[model samples]
Target: MRAVETGKKPVLSAEIFVIPIEADRFLVYAPLRRAAFVGNAGAVNFLADLREGRGDSGAGHDGEMIEFLRRLEIVDAGPETPPLAVFSDDPNPVSVTLFLTTACNLRCAYCYAAAGEGAARHMPPELARRGVDFVVGNALARGEDHFEINFHGGGEPTRNWPTLTKTLAHARRLADAHELRLTAYLATNAVLSAKRLDWVVANLHGASVSCDGPPEVHDANRVTPGGKGSSASVIRTLRRFDAEDFPYGIRMTVTADAIPRLADSVEYLCANFRPGQIQAEPAYPIGRGAGAASAETAAFVAAFREAQGRARRHGRELTFSGARVGTLTNHFCAATQDLFALTPDGSVSSCYEVFEESSPRAKIFLYGASAGAGGGWRFDREKLAFLRRQSVDRRAHCAGCFARWSCGGDCYHKALTVHDDGEFAGTDRCDIIRELTRDQILARIADSGGVFWHEPPERIAAEGCACVSCGDEGRIMTGRGVKKPDRGCV
Candidate 1:
């Protein structure tokens, strides 16, 4: 609160936060001001000396630095603005993820929900109808022209085909009545009946299949409840999807053992399935995988690079969850945006992994239910207050991170497992998020000449990424014009 210039000798800006990229270059970002500045080593030194009261403002070099920063409006102090309101008053969305049932055909080793092969619970028709009504009503109130519904859950949604179909039918009716465009998505194990497969292919806007990779790799961990390999059925499902021109992608959960085979797995998947996209995510130590350690960071990065290269050679795009370029966000996913995920029992859960009210984390994640008067759904503002507190601005540790907004301090559920408090401490994947984010940003700038998502790419230093480890490498563009380099790290 002291005057920014205590002695009026061109004091360093109170808003600027510098991240050194090299001895002569730095990435200066102001979280409060929402700005990023690239500085040369001279500017960095000048700023450091100024802050320490050793800089000579009379020097031409120092004068130029001050003038440049003054032009940026950080040199002069501004009136104190209140903390950024990252949380919205209306935490409502025009989307819903319907958990058709808590049952699955396969028991993957890393299954976060331990779905299926357990106490199976199917969502009642009444609850499903109410869930749809809740989201549709919000859409209507917001005057949205379209809304989305994703059929997904801890267990295989297709397993409860009756409830799934009924819910979709009810949602479709509501959409028609409201004259809203209904965009539906599906996430399935793909080990389903021919009728279900056909319905999904013909219905969904897009679908994500839970497939590890080749049979050997996939079956090793993703197995049937009765100790049988589920690869054959899933492979058949993928083949059917491909044959029918169904727009779908494969999602792989990378564990410690799967890390070594990642590249080979990508190659095999590309050779066999030719999926539209391959999303690979390292297993988080949650649910059934709680006891298992995640793959080594260096190992995962190396394997990801190799697999990415293999995927590129086959005209496929390899990606990881929350690793996309040109996307600047303060939350990792849509959970904070009021996207509802209805449990089989009709409990509204913010975190997909924390579905059961019996869960210890339920108090923080479970925010609503279909217990409103006349069977409508009701949201709990008190529980939602905890969720609202998780915005990026609330995490002090993430203030200096370049990926602070992109990753949003990682997953809330996972962050809770590691931290004993409400304030986000992030998960063990902090390093990975930072490195991957930096790599993606540099790769995008290299390909498009800037990071236009947050601002024009020209705002970044044009000389190229100053990271010495990555050096100057050619940025490869995918079919979608998204740039993801197969090599390099921050």
Candidate 2:
């Protein structure tokens, strides 16, 4: 904002967007201020005139429109954009994700890594020990009490049973030796044998299972080596998990063929199994699913919304990765957050999608490898810096997007594939993000008495949002008054 005098025409403070809904009605939104309202053409014109510095635009209705805009902090809001999260250059991480192997029992139609197609690469237990040692050393050096080890990779982690258990035992020994806590998580297909399932239930702190709904729906894609649907085994795993009361989340991948059954799938899962959270995503057109029909379409969005409704009735939540509306962020996932993921080859990968050397974007995401000796790792600082620079605020394509902050520029890997390493012009996922985000905004309004939706600046700041003005850390300048978040607010 330019310097304002005692009596000057006010300019638009926040980044405001006017989305046309129908013939005359418009959705006036200020993403930075977290304010949204439905308005007519007259209201839109009033805002335009104010932004263009016209004279006496808010003169009608006793200047009530001006007062209303001011209350919403869209007219004179100052510096309410959430702070862009920063990453460290030193890259000392306290968590490590081990991609156990490039082997799987199932040949999912959309297997990103094309697992089991090529010669399988199993992670040697010694490599796992080295990775764990590095993170545990970092945790101890940083005075952190706990370190995390996540089981994730291009293939089924349980396929490498020996290394998987050995890695956990090694991490436990280190945790005991250093008197630190060990947190472990697994992301698996859940097509496990009874012995392995029992071991997982007794061992891991939490797990994320991949199950795409009922038998027919799941069978369409997630099939075994013998071309049989793996849903029975998956359901058995879920039943075991429920019986043991294990902490877990269900991740469902919806292909184009399965989009119509999305709602039914969610209903089945909710009715039968108990998962702490249910995350749904359209199958990416990569690996074996490449050149296939695109699933990131309007129909998918409708199906997701319907599925969400079904889950809500069952007291469950269905989520899309890029459509988060309430959270404010600049990076979508740990891909941009320097995730310490060790591949089967002991090479470092920041993205779960780029776990294999054969990946098209492997050169871009695989940033480092082991230092060859004891416990140290090597990284390319230039690559790390490039990855760290990928924030939503830095993207030109996402500048005008209302969901930029919430979606955090969407998935970086997906962006690369969509644009072919060129400028991020956006992909079909952008529409899905916008539509879902708009729905979330409307839901917030209806939930909060159904007229307009506005979040207090201090409340946002209280949640560690560095959106203050006047260069003061203790005070947040808003249209209301100088407000401060209460101490120790979560």
- Colliding pairs, model 2: none
Cα lDDT of model 1 by residue, 201-260, tens digit? 887766777788888898888898787888888888888888988777777888988999
Taken over the whole model, the C-alpha lDDT of each candidate is: 0.65, 0.79
Candidate 2 residue-wise lDDT, 188-261, digit = tens = 89899899988999999878888899999999899998899999999999999999999888888888899999
**How many clashing pairs per prediction, in order?**
4, 0
Worst 10 residues of 2 by lDDT: 470-479
| Model 2 TM-score, all chains together | 0.90
Clashes of 2: 0
Error of 2 at 395 (Å): 1.9
- Residue 84, candidate 2: Cα error in Å is 0.9
Model 1 residue runs over 4 Å out of place are 1-40, 47-59, 62-91, 322-325, 421-424, 448-454, 457-490
True-structure lDDT of candidate 2? 0.79
